[model samples]
Structure formats: C-alpha cells, structure tokens
Target: MKTDLYLDMDHLLLLLLLSSGLQAEGSLNQTDFVRLVDGNSLCSGRLEVKSDQSNQSWSSVCEDDFDQQDAEVVCRELGCGAPSVLQGALYGEGEAPMWTKEFQCGGNESALLDCRSSGSDRNTCSPGRAVGLTCSEPVRLVGGDSRCAGTLELKHEGEWRPVGESVDEWTLEEADFACRELDCGSAVSVRRQESSDRSVWSISYDCVQSGSLRECAASDNSSHWLNLTCSDFVRLVDGNSLCSGRLEVKSDQSNQRWSSVCEDDFDQQDAEVVCRELGCGAPSVLQGALYGEGEAPMWTKEFQCGGDESALLDCRSSGSDRNTCSPGRAVGLTCSEPESFRLMGGDSRCAGTLELKHEGEWRPVFDDYPFWILEEADIACRELYCGSAVSMRREESSHRSVWSISYDCVQYGSLRGCAASSYSSTILLSIICSGLLLQPKISASSSMDGVSEAKQQGLLVFRGSDFTVSCSIQPQYPGGSFELRFTSSTSAHTYTQPAVNHSAHFLFPAAEPAHQGSYSCVYHVHVFSHDFSSESRQLSLIVVDPRSDQIINNPSKIIITVVVLILLVSTASYFYFKQKDVTVPPTVGSVDLQHVQSW
Candidate 1:
C-alpha cells in the first residue's frame, strides 16, 4: 500500500508541473495577439488587436471605444508600465481593418481579450481618429524620494538591475532620454556610482536611437552605475498657474501612478517637499478642494515627513493605509514662484536690479514703460517677501536682451504670470525695500567702570557714575538717524540724534535708579523718497547702590551678634530659675506653715 501511495504522489507532481508549463505558454502566446506597430519603440505606436476567431485577423482599435481603462489592460498585456500619453493618430494612420465592438475593460484585466465587449458594433472609424497609445517604458529611478531621482534601474530579462556603464560612455543625452521616458520633465544632472560585486545591465549608444533601454545590448563587466536627478516629478494641475493647483505625486518603481494626496494625510512638511520638488518657493497656502478634486485615485499612504526632506517619498509614512477620503478632501496647494524673478547686485535680498530667469538664463528686467513707478516696485517687493518698496531707479548699462514686464499685468499677479518677451534695452530697473535697512548696534561705557560690549543681559553700574549709551549701524546708505529708546517700570524716555558716521551717543551724567531699564536703538533712514527703519535688540541696564552692597556683605557679623543675644537670654533664664528655686521655696514654706496652723 505504501509503494502505491508513493507512485501516485509522483504522478500528481508531474501533472502539476505540466499544468504550470501550459499556463505560462498560454500567457506568452496571448502577448503575440497584440502589437504596437510602426513606432519608435515596442511600447508606443498604433495599437492593433488581433481576433481569436477561426480565421485570425489583426485590426486597429477605434479611438472612441478605447478609453484609459482599455489602454491600461493593453499596456499591461504588453509587459509595459501604465499608459502615459493617449492621442489620436500619434504614430500614424493605421492601415489594418478597424475593430467593430468596443472593449469594456475593468482596468485590472490581465489581457485585452479578457475584457468584456459592447453588444452593438460601431464599424466606422473617422480619419485622424485611430487610437494611438504610448505606454510608459519599464524604467525607473529607485532608492530616492520622488520618481524623478535616484539610482537608475531598468527592467531587463524579467528583473530590475542598476544600469551600469563606463564613466566616459554616459552623457546628458542618454540621461535626457531616460527622464523623458519616465515623464520626469528633463535631466538636471547625472553621476556615476561605484558598487560592490553585484549584477548590473549596461547599455550602449543604442538606447537613445532605439528609444528602448530594454532592447539595448548589455554588458556585465561594468562596475559603475548611473545615478540621475530630473527636474521635477510632482505637479499642480487645474489651477490658474503652475504654482497653484491640486497636488499629485508619482511614486513607486513597479507601477508608476500620479495619485492625489488627501488633505488629511498631508501637512505643511509634505507641502514643502512638493513645492521644492517643483522648483517653486515656500508653500503659501494649503487648502482642501481649492483647485477641485481631480479624477486621480486617493493616495493610499500618509506621509510623515520632516520639513527638510528633499523629496516627499523620502519621508517616512504611517503603517496604516488610507485609501478613502471624504468628498472635497483632496489637497490643493499654492507655492510662491521664486524661480522666475530675483534681485541681484545689491547689499540685501530686497535691494538690487530686478532680473527674470527664463529658459535657465537670467536677464535684467525692463518695465513696459520707460521707467518703473513705486506701485510696480511695491508689488515686486511683496513677491520677493521683502517689505514695501522704498525707491526705484533706472541705471543705463550696456544694451542687452531684457525681459519686458507689462506694467498692467504685474499690478494684478506675479511677474511670472505676466506676459514677457525679449526686448533690447540699456536701462536696468533697481529698487530698494523698506526691509532693507540693517539693524543698529548698541553699546554701553562708564567713566567709573570699564566699557561693556552690547549684550542682551543686564548691565551693572554704580550710583553717581557717568555712563554713555552708543548706537551705530553699518554704512550702507549715506545718512540716517538713531533714536535711543528707554523704558522703565515708572516712566519712559526717547532721545534722538543725527547719525554721525552711522553712530550716535547718549550721555547719562549720573547713574540713577530710573536709568535701570530696557534700552534699544532704532535706526531711521530716508532714501529712495521713502522712510525705512530697523530696530536693534533690547539691552537691559541694571543700577546698583554701593551702600546697599556693603550692608549685605556684612550679614555674617549681624548673624553672629543675633546668635550671641539668643545664648545670653537662655543662660540668664536658667540661672534666675535656679536662684529662685533655692530662696523662694524656704520663705514661702515658713509663711505658709504659720498661716495654715492659724486657719
């Protein structure tokens, strides 16, 4: 009986292996039914689906019947990533027969043939309406925060391996192709990474020509790997401008999906990462459903990020998955667009010649009018996070290309939002902000005591000593005034002096109790036809009395005298009780005995 059981078990195992082999073969054969033809790569072209009837025939899918759901299944069946771009006649007009019935794919099917079909037949396909699809290549950047940056890896031979090549073989062109294939904008930089003994797939120049990294020849002898950083991975959509819109993040190396982040799962830190990833300035506003909830799926994970993370995915996430969100729960963010306009060649960020960065090149700005006014400069200052504008000047330099800003458009929105064009001008617009003034410095010196540098702590001075408080500032502007402000529990006082060489002195002939208070220096400057001011940190002053110190220092003598008094009192009380006990007892007893006998 045992021998029979062993033989039966061996037979069952062989049957199971054969079944698995047949299933694998069937899957492979199904891929042959669909092909992307006459395109740059196998993953992108005019999509053609073959029928499974007795007489098999290939036909192009109608654009009307093919939706994103159907495209998802087709791309998956072709062993490619998700669909990236869908258009009509993207490759070329298909020459094959048009498909009749429409495909109703549920988006999770293993193959296009497995999906349901419409009952009715729509036979005609219009010109320039043939469905053309471009699926994302099976390429990714891993071990980084966003999809645009990290170690470059490709799906080759049914496995993912880092791309390895010699240092001199790789260039920006190859990196640009990879970035574009991944839909990561453009290539910013590329670096070679050395690794320990491991497996890698190296490519040659054929990768750019063929538009497919998988089809390129590979080398296993390379020890250097490719690391890339793309320009962007996250974007804001459906808003007024590029800096304000609904937040979408593309993540995960296996299936790249740009999903909207829920407002509940995102915070200021996450917004910061998104803004930085898009090359924008700090986040200005974060609201729910401000830009309208998009059709993308809600993010399944909650990002727990420190504010300083380079990428949103680099931050840690909560263990629990969050797949559901209430209506209007999608996050909408607004970031300041600082990449376009900047101040240069000035002492501070708020004061300089206004320049605009376009196409990665900085050019000086020229107003639509011949001169810039205070109102336009005020708007520019506010955009730069500088205070209100103080003054505007036009300096004539060598003539060059400049970005002309429409004065009317900038009055309403950012300079970047305004329509700009290249213009030749010799004048450069420069402006100073009210926030450009430097903080003043405060110091104290006394005739009786030595000089003390400016400090936040209290300053000590003896009574009847002469002291001076000096206020100074860095020489940036020509002239300014210093106001020495003093505040005490009972009263307050203000002293003003014209700044001489950016310094002012206030003398106190006698150190009084009223002088002990918080003192500060406010520097006031008038330039560019506007008044600007900056106040220094508070300097606390403390007054002391010499007699009081002497009294407190002699406390030990007072304590010893009190101790002697206490001892004398206790000794006297003890002796008086002892003397009374001997004499009063005898006198009282003699008188009491006589009186008791008489009673």
Candidate 2:
C-alpha cells in the first residue's frame, strides 16, 4: 500500500507540473515546489510550498525546518545570489494549511522535496510561523565612508567577500557596471588595493561595457582586492541651478532609468538630507512639482530623516509598495548657502537683535534708524530662510561705539541689494521674523464638528461613523487662512476656512468608503501682496466595518472559511470512525451488549 501511495504521489506531482506548463524534462528543482510571497523582490518574502495537488494552492513552510543549507538551494533555484539572512515570520503571518514536514537538506540538493524529510503531518500550526529570507545581492560595495564609494565585493557561495586575482585585471568599464548595479552613478575611480584583514575569496570577472556586473564571465583566482569610488547619482533638474530643481533618483535595476520623487510625501527633513548629500547648503524652499509635472513612475515612499543622515537611502522610508504618488506631485527643492549675517541676544535665530557684516567686521545698526521698515526686515529674514518679518522693535541700552550701517529695502531684492545709510550710530536694532520652523498638528474625533470641549485623538473609526478632522496652527496670524484637503486612491476633496480662526474643521456626516485615505492642511497668508503657504504632514485614517469586523471587504475570505470548515469536518469524521473500531467490548454482566453493538 505504501509503495502504491508513493507511486500515486509521484504521478500526481508530474501531472501538476505538466498542467502548469512546467516541463518535466529532468529532476524536480526548488522553483518547482517553493515560492515567495508578500515582498517587492523575488529574494524577499515569506516562503511557501507549491502544493502537488494543484498549482493554485500553497502551504506556508515552517521556519523550524529552514536553515542556511535550505536557503542556499532556494536562492540557487530562484536564479538569485546566496541567502543573506533568514527570518521567522518577519514578513507577516500566512493563511492556513502550513507545511509540517521537517527537511534535512545536505546543502547540495537541487530541490527541497528531494531532501530527506521526517514525513510528519500536523493538523494545525501557529499563526505567523512561516519562513522568510533576504537573498544576498550579486554585487555590492564595502569598506567606504559612503555606500557609493567602497571596496568592491562579490557574492560567492552565499557569502560576500573581496575579489581576489581579478583586481588587477578589472577595467574602468567593469567598475562602472558595478557602480551602476548598486545605483551609485558611474565609476569615478577604480584602483587595486591591499586586501583587508578579513578572508578574501578568489573570483575572476570578464565584464563588458554593456549589461550588469552579474552578466560578466566569472571564475576563481587569487589576488589583491579592488577599491572603487562612484559619483553621486542624485541630481536636480529643470531649475536655474543644479542645487535648485525637481528631484530625480536613478533606478538601481538593470534598466537604469531615473524616477521623480513625490513632493506630497517629501518633507523638509528629506530635503535637508538631499542637499547635504549633494554638497549643497540647507534647503531654503521645497516646492511641489513647481517646475513641471513628471511622467509616470514617481517615487511614493515618505522619507523620514533626522536631519543628519549622509545618504538619502540611509534614512528610514515607507515601503516600496506605497506607490500612491502621481507624476503631478513630483518634488522640487531650492537649497541656499548659509547666511553671512545672524541674529544675536534673543531666544531664537528669528527673534533676535540684528547684526550686520561690513569690511570683514561685525557691527550693529542704529535702533532709532530712520530707514528701518518691514520690507528691509523681510529681506533679512528671507536671506536666513526664516520666512517673513513678523515684528520689528528697538532695543535700548547704554551706548557701544561700534560701527553701524543702515539699509533701505523698499519691498524688493535681497538685503545685500539695499543701499547703506551714510551715517552710523551706537544704538542697536532688534527685529522678530516669522519662521518656517512651525508645523501644524492634525487631529480627528467621532464627535460633532466645532466642539471645543471634545479632545482630539486616534483616527480609528467604524464604517458609517460620523467624524471630524481638525487642524490647529501655532503663532496665529489674523490674515492667515486654513485649507484642508483629503485624498484617497480615486479622488480628492478640499475645504477652506477664512482667516478669523486659528483652527479649521471639516465635518463628514458619516465615514463613507470614498472618504478613507490621507488628510493634510495648509496655512496661507498674504505678505506684501504675495501669498505664502505652509503645509502640514499627512495623516492617515482607516475605517473599519463593524458588521464584517474587517478593515475592508474581501470576497476570498468566504471561500477560505467554507473550505476550512469542510476539512475540519472530514478530519473529525475520519478520527471518530477509526476510534469506534478500536473501542473495548462491554462486559457480559452489564447486560448492554445489544445497546453497545448498536452504538
């Protein structure tokens, strides 16, 4: 019977392969039985077993049976490099029908099913108990200050080590291919260097000018390591200067295309990182698709930076699956050099007494200077990238006979363009300017709109629940108006409020399917007849349906639930019948032989 079952299983597996268009030409490989799920790349995601019963069905593989040897076969069969890391349920849980068989791979098996197995079958498995893996990239850079410039490392036998003999033989074209593979621009410098203290691997490469480094001819040899430096890949386009324009990042894939970044997701912190990476000063202004809209394939990840990261890729960002941004929202940035003049003796850079620079000497202006006006102060603040002038005042104290220079800026040009006053004074001038440092906070509630007593909190809501979104601005200005906008996958809606209130509210009668998405607010005010707007960070609202107890309606769940119930009933029936035949017979004295026989 066991021999017959084995033959039946092999026949079934062959039929599955033929029906799925997979040729049954040779021994079964790992790709024929193993697959990845829920990841952006083939090298990532939860591991699952392709059921021999059908191509459409799969069972989650257990991490308990996973090891480096198993991962090696999986990666090799998938046409990827060796496995860099293996994780247990790190990518998230899988649906039922987990594979319970334990594999004992010898690290040389071509297929997972060909390896020795314990043949254990389990009725149930713990949730989130699946295997995950991150395969090593074929080419990488190492031992450098930045990811772009580093010692070239190649993957051999699931490990990344410095190239050995091929170091002297490597050409500029080969180095360029390596740099492009890592998406770090073209190779600027390639030189032979002494190997590090770490172990070195013997590898030879015959790379061509075209194609990726992975496509190069490779062999084993022993020699020195190669160090390389790649030029900065990021660039600004369609602006007056290189440091001011639309932001586009080069793709690390084989196509080597460039993609624009979405301004709606790019924030000031992200802008700072980009400027610093490009050798530019801090960002003066970040515009949203200002130059012009881009084409398709815009980056949608929201970059989160701590204002100190060396590379934009080093900062934490949203997952690549979030492709919510369109070409119309491409990001633009204007970076500026640090200001020559600075404020002193005040709480902050924007609200301090003013100082001037002249002839390489620091001096102060007259407090009672006749030409002092808001326009001049505005230019000074603009030079510092501190928004506009909020207030200007005189700081009175005992006289210090330092040199003073006055400027008359009549609502035009930079502070340096203003003409200096002929006279000098000992008194100092003090001014306070509105800074771009403030960011508004957004909150949501289930209560009625415009209710001051209700506290704003988390955004979790049920379907058909009435909700209100409010945005509160700091350092309120009388002429500033608030605009609230809501965006979903298909459409967007906006609401506006006049300048009378510092806080704005948008009331929804009930949470509809269309109303679920991201929301943000902007504060705009007219300064010198020109409008300036400050935008807030985006907030996401998730609406759950109480009737279904799910965030959204999924049609597949119904079928899965029915299938699970049927399997449970079949297993229970089989166990019950098997136990009935093995039950002990009742004693003759009990006088229940007829009843026992009937049961």
Candidate 3:
C-alpha cells in the first residue's frame, strides 16, 4: 500500500511539472514574446522583446546593440517579408526596460531568441535609441505570368492562400492596397473568378488597421477569388537612377527571387516593355552587362514580350529552357527619364503648358527662338509618353522668371538637358499631342478554348482547328479600322477589317502551319483633324499537329509502361498456379502441399 501511494505521488508531481512547462511554452508562443508598438502598421513600430517565459515582462532593445542582422530575425519571427528600414526612435521610445545584451544574429535565424548574444553591456539605454523597424509586408500574387499580375494571395498563419470575397465587395481601394503591398505599383484592373467551394483567407479593409493582412480572418470555404493587375512591375537597379540599370525580373512572387535576364535572350521589344513598365520615355540604350552583372540567379527562360505589356512578366517565354549564360551576358538597359518634363494647365498630360524641371525647380519655358516651340514640341511630347506634337500656341502671361530653353540643344536629349538660363518672359508656349487614340486590344479565340488576350506561352492549336483573332479598342472614338499584322520568319502578311461597334473579328476556319506566326492590332482613327494610330502588343500563335502527342518519345515513359505490364503478368501467373494446386488433391509423395501452404 505504501509503494502504491508513493507511485501515485510521483505521477502527480510529474503531471504538475509537465503542466507548468506546457503553460510556459503556450505563453511564449501566444505572445511571440516580441512585438512592435506605437507605429502605423504591425510591421513598423518600436521593437520590444520579452525573453523570460516565466513572466509577461517586456523590454525594449537598444539600437546601439542592435543592427540589420538582428532586425532580419525579428522581422522573420513576426512573419514580415523583409526589413526595409531600421533606425532609432523611428516609431517612439517605449517605456519598457532596456535589453542589456547585444544580439549577435546572423540574419538567417527563424526566431530572434534562436540567435546567439553577447554579454550584458549596460542596464540602462540612452534616450531616443530604442530600435525601430519597418518590414516589407508579406503579401504576394500567384498563378500569373508575372509578380504584378496574378491572383491575389496573402500569407496568414504561416500559409499562403488566395483572398476570398464577393465580386461586388472588392473595390479599387482594396486592389491598390494589394498591389502596393507586392511593390507592384498602383492597381489597373481587378477580376473575379468563381470556383468550387474551397478554403481561403478573407480580408476586411477595416480590420487591416495595422496594414498587415495577418489580422484578417480565414473562411472555411469560398467560391470567389480575386485577380489583380498593377500598372508597373519592372524596375532598374545599380545605375544612375530608376531609368537605367541591369534588368532583374520577379516572375514569381512565391520565392521572391529577382532573376537577371540574359542579353542574348532579350530583344528590342522586350526592352520596350521594360521601359514602358517603369513609366519611362523609351529605350535609349540596351547592351550586355552595361550596368554590371548581378549576383542573383539568371532567368531560365527568355522573354518574348509584345512591347505593349503593362509588366514584363506578362510576356511569353521561350519553350526551350536554358539556365546557363556566358559571362557578361546579363542584359543592361537605359530608359529616358520622363519625370523632369511635363505639361501643366492643359486638358490632359499630353496637352499642357510646357514646364521644364531644372535644378529642383519647375519653371515655365520661354522658347528663345520662335520656331523652337514649333519644331521641338515633338521632343517634349515624346518624352511625356505621347505622340508627335499636333499643334502649338503661345499663351500670354504676366512677366515672370522663366527658363529660356534652346531648342537646338534639345534635339540631343530632353528639354531639361538643353542649354537654358533664367529669363523674364511674358509668353508661355503650349502644345497639343495626338492623345485621343488608345491602344487597341488583340485577342485570339480558338475552337479548343475561349478567347485570351495575354497568352504568355503563346497559343497552341491543333492542325485543322478553327481559330479567330479579334481586335477591340476602348470607347474613345466612333469609327476606326483594325489592321491584323502577321509576321513569320519566311513571310509577313496583313489583314484589314472595318471596325464595327469599335471592334472587328478575323475568322480563320482552318488553322494551318502557315498561320503560325506573330499577330498584332493597329487601330487608325482621324480625330482633331489629325491622323492618329496606336498599335497593340504582339500575340504569338502556334499551329501544331495533334497526332504528335500520341507517340511515346520519352524513354522514361516507355520503361514505366513495360515495368507495369510485367508486374501485371507475374501477379496473374501466381494466382493461376495457386488455384490449380487447390483443385488437385494432395498425393502421398507430393511435398508440394507443404510448399504451397508456406507460400
């Protein structure tokens, strides 16, 4: 009886110890033991740490002892993407006690406490030195060709799931938030795709008080998913400004890898897309390793952009894959910066009073030569991402300090780069551009599938399949003609159609190998007494023989098929022999009975 009682007491003590240990672990996990406070977002605030699991006392880390490596671990622990900014007292000084030890983090730790630390340096920290951090939001877009255009997904509870909401519930505000979170600029369009009920995360704009989607709720089953497209995705790096650098592309947001494109694989069309996506004027220079080779991995596939894509990732890639590139083969591009020159006080950006930004100040330009305004207006219009100058006029203004721009020097570069000096002039030159025409959209509809606008991998159709290429433009003009341009290695042909209801469809009853080529749409309209034309990005079509799929060309598939057939035959033979043995009666000398029973 005494033994039994002692054993019961030991078990009770073990249970108590385990219960307390579990409680401590639960508390540590619940609080993450670290937090950012007094900032606009959960990812940006004063950094506080709670090391002791036995108590809830929290302390702040001194910026003197903390560095970027330490900040990385904290951001990872908080489920943020990365640390973008780190400073002292950026949010505010916290009231908690200072952490005395210096954190020796290697920047790859999963949690802050997982890293090593130095001995205690001090008990009290100086004023206004509390660590403040701002981490990039953990948001991404998936299931699209590029990072900027895709189905919206957010990281929650260590898992990535698509956002779920009614189609009508989402607005431009929500879309813009998602685009900005991915660093893809502002939103241009949003689409809803209804699918079978599935588990997904739902975010409420109001609940996003911290600007973190972590606070959002997850729904068990939702049928609606959001697809968003942003205005820009490509960015330049390692050069003079945002307009020039080695090209790095973020095709997939899941891994967050920005890969460098090979110069041999990138072409002028691809350069055009990169410049346009960055909101620059045009491609001024493109060369191999011009800016400098990057440390990131080289992109596996070559970009075949149509030159009109809003983002680089929206372009198609080569079918053959090659990961290796020769040294100094990475593409470097330079785009003309368009931010310095603008036309203000006009109906649109294209039509406005010319203003030149010189030496950090925007000043009205007074053409020193009268013909300079008429001859060089095209230069200003092109820099502003508009067509050639259609008309120019002089507006009378009060005598004010203005820039006397030299048009002779403007032909070399932007108007701001021209020779200019301060001058008092009473005339401000204004110009109008051919901005009434919008780019026409080109889409292909096949018998096998529906219409698609941006086929990144290009469209593949079986031989003899029916397909139609359609062209449509936005409702800006009443009448315009659509020109379908087709180009191949051997030949080029164009088909024209009258635009009805602002759209035209070119039907092909049977697809042939000759039809395999690139197609684009050119919209031509006469408006404002000027002939204006805008072209859509190219669309690639491939006509393939369906019978090619029936042949088993892969050696692995052949081996797998032969192995499966052999296994099937062997199993059948074993069963057949066993049944025959059972039917036959056992004879005296037949040791087969024992052998069969063992088998």
Query: How close is every model to the real structure, measured as TM-score?
Result: 0.50, 0.29, 0.37
Q: Please give, for residues 1-599, the per-residue lDDT of candidate 1 as tens digits.
A: 00111222322343465567755232335566688888778789998876433346778888888888889999888878779878889888867888776777789998876666765667688998888999988889997777788999888767888988732245444675687678885455566677775778877743554558777737576666788877565667676554678988775534455778899999999899877765577999999999999888888889998989887767898989986899998999998876678888886788989998754568998887635689999989987879888788888978589877766556645676452445788888898877787788888766653545565344656667888889999988877899999998788999999999999999999988778788999999876567788998888766655544421122243443444455456556656767777443332222221111111
Query: Any idea how many clashes model 1 has?
Result: 0
Q: Which stretches of candidate 2 lie above 4 Å from their native place?
A: 1-8, 11-74, 82-136, 142-150, 156-161, 164-191, 196-209, 220-224, 228-260, 264-272, 275-309, 312-326, 332-599
lDDT of 3 by residue, 1-599 (tens): 00111222322343466567755243445236579999777778999987444566788888988888888888889888777668899988867888767777779988776666664356778899999988777777788877778888878788888887632145444565666566665454556667777778887643543356656646546787778776554555576544577888765665344678889899999999888776566898999999899786788888888888876868898988776999999899998775767888764677778887654578888887634755588878776778789988888998498876666556544454352435778888888887647778887767765545344435656568888888999876678799999999889999999889999999899988789788999998775466778899988776645454311222333443444455456566666767778543332222321111111
Ranking by lDDT: 1, 3, 2
Candidate number with greatest lDDT: 1
**How well does candidate 3 score on lDDT at residue 83?**
79
Off by over 4 Å in 1: 1-233, 238-241, 250-258, 263-273, 282-296, 302-321, 325-336, 344-349, 369-373, 393-396, 411-413, 416-419, 548-599
- Model 2 — TM-score against the truth? 0.29
- Candidate-wise lDDT, in order: 0.74, 0.62, 0.71
Greater-TM-score candidate between 2 and 3: 3
Higher-TM-score candidate among 1 and 3? 1
Ranking of candidates on TM-score, top first: 1, 3, 2
lDDT of 2 by residue, 1-599 (tens): 01111223654566578568786555354466777788545556788876544444687877776678888877766656567557788777777468766666667876666565554555565666688876644666778977777777766555666765443244444555566556565444556676445566543333333333444435554445777776555666675443567887764444345678887778888889888775456898887877776563676567788889986778887775565775467888887743436787764576677765532456665533455777777877877778888777666756474433334222422332222322344456677777833666677666422333223223545568787878777764456777888888789988898745577777888887777787888888765234567788777666656566455533444543444455456556656666777543332112211221111
User: lDDT at 65 for candidate 2?
Assistant: 63
Q: How accurate is candidate 3 locally (lDDT)?
A: 0.71
